[model samples]
Target: MLTNQAIRNVANDLDRRWISDDYFDLIVWYETEVQIHGFQLCYDKPGRERALTWTRERGFLHTAVDSGESKPTANRTPIVVADGTFPAGQVRREFIARSGLLPAEIRELVLARIKDYEDRQSA
Candidate 1:
């Protein structure tokens, strides 16, 4: 089964919790082929990948958190990013892209970074 392994420390969008520097949910699954800055993840439930949908079909768009709607998956989950690394992910990349920021310019902006990115980037 897929699972969350860590969270990145930084900042988050004021309107959305999914894309943030404070807590970027990092997921790991051997079956997935996603490579969003070396971190593969799932924003929605299992089998809900938007990239698989037809071009004419509507893709998954995240909704703002609702009061008493449901609990987040990472509630009390024991995982975190170390001090030397930076956060990264598709959510952060998209957020930056949407905001007219280039991928190379933004280092500390991301929704999730791979758990081992710093080690890999350094090597």
Candidate 2:
């Protein structure tokens, strides 16, 4: 299970730009770790798809420009990179399978745990 603090920490790291282009690959790395640890986390499929589309589109354009197949356009908007998109649906499915919990159930559990953790920390 992923705690709220853990998620916040990752977000903060991202805000600091600690994760670079290679951060996309870290999704697989974290998923693997979760599998080995027998933990489950909630994932939004639609959100994942959006991320995939974003990363793929940007990566394709980047490669085209680098190989001289395409030229950069000053009028083109900069590509927006999202958090995790690697392995797409597979990551979410594997996580749910390994955790033996439905996505909604996992989300509820995580939320409850986060509340508990926050309460304790505050006290």
Candidate 3:
């Protein structure tokens, strides 16, 4: 599974510019592939949190906890997931793409990083 540490590591490795825009989707994919329960991504706005909650409530995967801050939040408090194997990269990429993000390469890269992190953790 994708632990907070692993997710953070992957997020840290990716270009922050790329990650800031779509980290939630990566988190959701990681959580779903790993079959984690009650996972949450802490954000600053209740609206963002609510958005994540909507996704989770729909049984998509994961949730977000908005910190209610005025300023836009950085990638604080990486998402956590119970330990488990994730889906293959192609499958993960497809999943994220379907979620509405563009440029398939971004999701592909994220999935690659996630797999790398998971491998390191297991090793």
Candidate 4:
């Protein structure tokens, strides 16, 4: 569970978070209600890190992280860059396997969001 105030705090929104061995990080947000409004899941920190972001209004976004290491000499800030495709199958499976520690509702919602993304992709 992540408790960092700077990272977790958002105006008029509630959050649930989980972090595992620096490899996987998940944050789900709700707007003062039971319904989830958005979430951001980041994975594969050791390699080419990527994130799957989903918002109720904006939908899903898959992005690769630029760890600011491309130029060792320059101190650059890490940022998210466009990712070509979302590996929906692998990510959904992985999330199911690792999200056992999260609350059942939160986990289920995340899975449902992933499924929604997959359905959109296949359409």
lDDT score for candidate 1 against the true structure: 0.29
Report the lDDT tens digits of candidate 1 across residue range 61-98.
Answer: 22322223245753453222223223234444544444
lDDT scores in order = 0.29, 0.29, 0.36, 0.76
Query: Top lDDT: which candidate number?
Result: 4
- For all predicted structures, in order, the TM-scores are 0.19, 0.21, 0.28, 0.78
User: Which residue pairs clash within candidate 4?
Assistant: none
User: Where does model 2 exceed 4 Å of error?
Assistant: 1-102
lDDT string for model 4 (1-123, tens) is: 322223645566566544454566777777656877788888777777899998889988989988887676988888999998778898787787777767788788888988988898899
Which ten-residue region of model 2 has the weakest summed lDDT? 60-69
lDDT (10s digit) by residue, model 3, range 55-104: 33453233344344445665455443433333334334544544354345
- The candidate with the higher TM-score, 1 or 2, is 2
Clash pairs, candidate 1, are: 10-21, 11-21, 12-20, 88-112, 88-113
Determine which window of 10 residues in candidate 4 has minimal summed lDDT.
Answer: 1-10
Candidates ranked by TM-score, best first?
4, 3, 2, 1
The predicted structure with the larger TM-score, 2 or 4, is 4
Off by over 4 Å in 4: 1-18, 71-75
